[model samples]
Target: MRRIVGADAVCALIAGALGYLVRFGPAGTDGQHVSLGVALALPLVWVAAMLVARSYEERFLWVGADEFRRVFFASALLLATVGTVSWAFKLDVARGFVVLALPLATLLTLGQRYAQRQWLHRRRRHGLFRQTTLLVGHRAGVESLHQQLEREAYHGYRVVGCALPGGRDVAAQFDGLPVLGDLDEVVDIVRGFEVDTVAVLPSPELDGPALRRLGWDLEDTRAELLLAPAVTEVAGPRVRIRPVAGLPLLHMERPELTGVRRLTKGAFDRTSAALGILFLAPVLLGIALAVKVTSHGPVFFRQERVGRDGRTFSMLKFRSMVVGADRMVDDLAEESDGNGVLFKKKDDPRVTRVGKVLRRYSLDELPQLINVVRGDMSLVGPRPPLQGEVERYGYDMHRRFLVKPGLTGLWQVSGRSDLSWDDSVRIDVRYVENWSLTFDFMILWKTAGAVLRGSGAY
Candidate 1:
């Protein structure tokens, strides 16, 4: 917490000083209006706003996007407070000073926090900051929870052992978490391992009163109680806990697919796509020229893809395959190394020499900006699926069409062509169910790293 606060303060101070210089050009007027006093106070005010916003809270800092979102809101609040004060007092504050300081502080502070998070991730990977957890459940449920904890180490849980119901499986084991004892000896296991958390998964033997009694028994110790729901892959934002009568019920809000939220997303997609095309004109043209010069086919390839509402659109791409490549699909069907529904061959003979390089780095997808602009696709959503792939879609698979397809999406950033059909479906459906402008931005940010690595791209 101290480190995070210090970094945030330092970044705020730097932004204030830089903004001061940009506004006043290093004037030696210390006591004058719009002077050093104002600059110094800006950092203090920003820090206070961050503190009030609880940006440095321990639970928020270690995981997820909420911490950074809080920081951003705090910065906005600081700016709003500054603006109000300046207006109310009719102070001669330069607009440029506030304008520059807010964004600079946000950028620098976000960068610093990202650096800290990476350091924390490295430490956590080495088992630092992890809780030695004792899980209580049936053998199957215990193992399920154990697998999840091991899979997501960032959650800070390390299963030390398991306690099965009724001493039945006391000598058994699930994965590597040995059945240290039964439910009756759960507290004993917690004491023995010096466990910091006792995670409870649903089992027939443990009912409501039994779990409450367990919690009461652990109250004398430092160990925390956690309930592991069987539900998986649901994001934090969607889950809401409500105390109805004496029962605590969990409700998941439906994904917002209509109304203003949907409209805002559409606006963002088209505007960003248009700006992207303008900014990358030189690179786009160069790629087009390269494709035309190095391949026998046209510079662009337009393929039919399923988009929102199961509508078909001609998704554009920089041609990276031989002319009449579609004709070769049947012949190479047996050679497919792709996920079941998608036809992907890592070393397809149809990919031209220039095509290999283009596909590897996803340079071929740049032309999809046109699709984005035309409203058939988004900048970030599901992977634009082929028409034939949609033909294999089961009943529930149609949920992916709730949003427009994307040039780069959860599927693209995750593993692209290397993803199994199930993996691809999971991520895309997750994206559809949890769509937000902030979440979209996060995916776009991760997309750069995925493209650079080129690990999964064909």
Candidate 2:
């Protein structure tokens, strides 16, 4: 916390100095003196604003978007306070300095926070700086929470033990962790184990009053209580806590399937795709030439893919197979290395020499930019599925058609061909349910690293 405060203060000071240099130049005068005074005071005020916004709170630190949101709030609050004070006091505050410094400081602070988060995540992955967590819930809920925490170890939750509803009588150990006690013994177990966090999963035994009491009991301990509601895979933006008649209710907003945000996403997709196409024209041409010369097939391979609303569109990709590769699907089906639904082979005989290189780095998907431009696809969304794959989809999987398929999506960045069918479905459905511009941007950013590594690309 102190480190974050210090970093933010330094960022504010640097921004102020830069703003002063840019706005007032190197001149030494009364104006310079006043600017220096303001610059000296800015960092202190900025840090205080961040404190008021609770940006440095441990709960908001090293995880989620809430920390960044608080930082932004602090920036806005600081700006408002400065403007109001300057206006009320008739102070000669430099407009350019305020404008430049505050925005720059916000950016710098956000950047520093992101860097710190990455560092923390790296440490957590190596089993450092993790919180000792104690689970309190039913057997099934405890097991599920434990598994999830194990999978996302970078979240810094080390599940030490669990306290089920029925305690040791139910089982000696749950999910390979020692069963501490029952739900009623959570606080005692936390204290005994020196737990850093107590995660309470939903259970019939823990009602409103009981949960409130548990919270009150944990107040004296160093452990923080975290409530893991039954709801899963929903993004924070979609869920809100609404207090009505003294009851806190979880309100989930309907996914934005058809609205102004969707329209904006479409616009962004088209604009970004068009710019991408223009920028990568040379690379596209080079790939086209390579495919044309190395393989006796069209430069582009057009395949029917299921898009939004189960609509079929001809998805484009640079040819990465022999001319009659599709005809040999049945013959090669037995040797498949894919996740049942998707047919992928690491060493398929149909792939040409140049095709191998194209598929490795995902250069083959470059032509999908045209699909994005034509509104048949998005830059980020559920992966476009083959018609056969769509036909085999379960009813819940159909929800992925709520938005257009993407050139790259959760599935792409996650593992691409290496992901199991169930994993792929889960990831796609998760994205479909939690669609947002920010989510898309995050997926797109991850896509770049995924492509570079080509970890799952066959």
Candidate 3:
């Protein structure tokens, strides 16, 4: 926390000096003296605003978008305060100074925070600076929560032990973590284990009153209590707590499918797709030439894929397999290396020599930008499934069709062909349930690294 404060202070000072230098040049003018005074005072005011906004709170630090949101709020608050004071006092505050200083400070501070977060994540990956956690719930819920925390180690949770509904009789150990005690002994267990976090998963025994009492019991301890609700895969923006008649209710907004947001998404997809195609014209042509020269078939491959609402579209790709490769599916079915729903062979006989190179760097999928331009796909969405694959879909999997299939999506960025069928479906459905422009942008950003690594491509 002190490191963050110090870094923020340095960023603010740098931004203030930079703004003053840019707005008022090095000259001994009347405005120069006032500008220097303002520049000197900016860092103190900026840090104060951050304190007022609670940007330094431990819960908001080291993870999630809340920290960035608070930083933005603090910057806005500072601007609003300055604007009001200038207007009320009729002081000659330079608009250029305020404009240059506050925005620069915010950007610098955000950059510093990002750098620090990256450093912290690197340390956490090696099992450093993590919170010792104790799980309290039924075995099933505890196991589920434990797995999730393990998967996302950067969140800084290290599950040391658990307290189940029943003590040792239920089970001596769970997934290798010692079963500390029963729910009744959680407070003692937390203190004894020096737990930094106590994660209480949904359980019948821990009702409202019991949970409240547990909270009161842990008040003197250093452990922070976290409740894991049954609801899963919902993003923060869609969920809100509403206190109605002294009872807190979780309110979830409906997914944005048909509205101005959808319209904006469509426009962005087409426009960006068009620009991408234009920018990558040379690379596309080069790949087409290579495919044509190395293979006995056409340079382009078009396959029927299920899109939004189960509508089928001809998804385009640079040919990465031999001609009539589809006819050999049954012959290679037994040798398939794919998750049951998707057929992927790491070393398939159908893939041409040039095709391997193309698939390795995901060059084969470049033509899907045209699909985006045609409104048959999005730049970021669920994977486009084959007609046969759609036929085998369960009812829950159909939720993925709520939006157009994407050129790249959670499946693509996560592991592409290497992901299990269930994982792929879950990721796609989760994305559909929490669709937002910001989420799309984040997926798009991750896509570049995924493509470069080429870890999961067949």
Candidate 4:
């Protein structure tokens, strides 16, 4: 919710500035028909579209490309809506002005957002612009919470230390963060450190009355209290808070993969895949030729992978390893640095020279676009697990097969093979839980940057 408010403000400012530029390039600035009326109308259109499209809603800010997609979709709707109204009302609307305004507005808004994220990240690295946090939880919970906060510098939180309830040992330091004091000193901890946020990580023996009282005490102070659940990789949208009889009940919505949603997703996948194949046809051909000429094997690698509902599909890719690479699995396992379930090597002897280039820029995954068109895959989804990995699945791991696997996903944009199998499953499950078209686009956008950087590809 906070992210949406921040983003909406940024979008409004950028859109308004662009509208000005469109209305009066220079002469209007010289006080000739400034068109303040048109400028005002433009923001109204954008804001209305934003609201209608739910672009400024809370569900999308932290994840993949949903925010940007909503911006795009809303901007288009704004232009179309106002354009229609102008014709009906016989208002003097300039097509040239709107054409110039919309794209510029979107570009500037997204650019500024990226800049702000960079600035915020830098501030967090130095422990500046950080909210002073009083960690309230058990030792292990506090340690995990602290590390997570540290890893995501963009979150902009400074852990002053922890105040655990009924905590043992009452250590002076925990994972380099000081254990300020015990539970009874919660109020003092808040005051002494000037803490602005109290993050309560879940504890098995957490006192319900004490927690309630802690909230009461915090109401007097200007501190924001946050309860960090044991849930990992679960997105905000899946959780809903309802006040029933004064008890704040938290409900987690189950994953849905049927009816209109399934159809909508299928349409999205096919259309995107078709367009992608058309767009990258030339590049695909060139890469295929290069691989065929450079290597003494098949141009493509057709491997059976687990897909939606544990269905088996031959996922396609430009062959990166030697012919019969499957036979040497045990040999390579000896050299694997990948998470236990998956097989990966940063530098493998089997990779041909052309394969190296293909893998770096992610050209190897081009064939998956065909799979997308065939309804065997999606443009954005959880990374497809190999058949063997699927066979080894535990109860939680089964969630990864709830949706069709994708060419790019949270797992890809995140550290890729660098991430542990446990972490990969968690991210994949999160995506499944909060699946959306906008999210797919976000992951697709980030995939381009990831491919460009070639970070953790192997």
**Residue-pair clashes per candidate:** 0, 0, 0, 1
Task: Write the residue-wise lDDT of candidate 3 on 1-458 in tens digits.
Answer: 99999888888899888888788776634845666777898888888999999999998999888999999999999999999998998777778988999999999999999999989998998899999999999888888888878867999999999998778888889987899999999999988989999999988999999999999999999999999878888888899999989999898889888899999999999999999999999999999999988889899999999999899999999999999999999999999999987888999999999999999999999999999999999999999999999999999899999999999999888888888887887889899999999999989988998999998999
Q: Taking the tens digit of each residue's C-alpha lDDT, what string does model 1 give over 312-398? A: 989898999999999999999989999877888998899999999999999999999999999999999888888888888886578
Candidate 1 has its poorest 10 consecutive residues by lDDT at 27-36
Superior by TM-score: candidate 3 or candidate 4: 3
Stretches off by above 4 angstroms in model 4 are 1-107, 122-128, 167-170, 204-209, 219-222, 230-232
Residue-wise lDDT of candidate 2 within 98-216, one digit each (tens)?
99999999999999999999999999989999999998888788887787788679899999999987789888887899998988898899889899999998888898899999999
- Return the candidate ranking by lDDT, descending: 3, 2, 1, 4
Kindly report which residue stretches of model 2 are placed more than 4 angstroms away from their true locations once superposed. Answer: 329-335
Highest TM-score model number? 3
Model 1 / residue 40 / CA error / Å: 4.8
lDDT of each: 0.85, 0.90, 0.91, 0.78
Better of 2 and 3 by lDDT: 3
Arrange candidates by TM-score, highest first: which order? 3, 2, 1, 4
- Residue pairs in collision within model 4: 65-442
TM-score of 2: 0.93
- Cα shift from native, residue 383, model 1 (Å): 1.8
Evaluated at residue 435, the lDDT of candidate 2 is 88
**Worst-scoring 10-residue span by lDDT in model 2:** 26-35
Error of 2 at 321 (Å): 2.3
TM of each candidate vs. truth? 0.84, 0.93, 0.95, 0.80
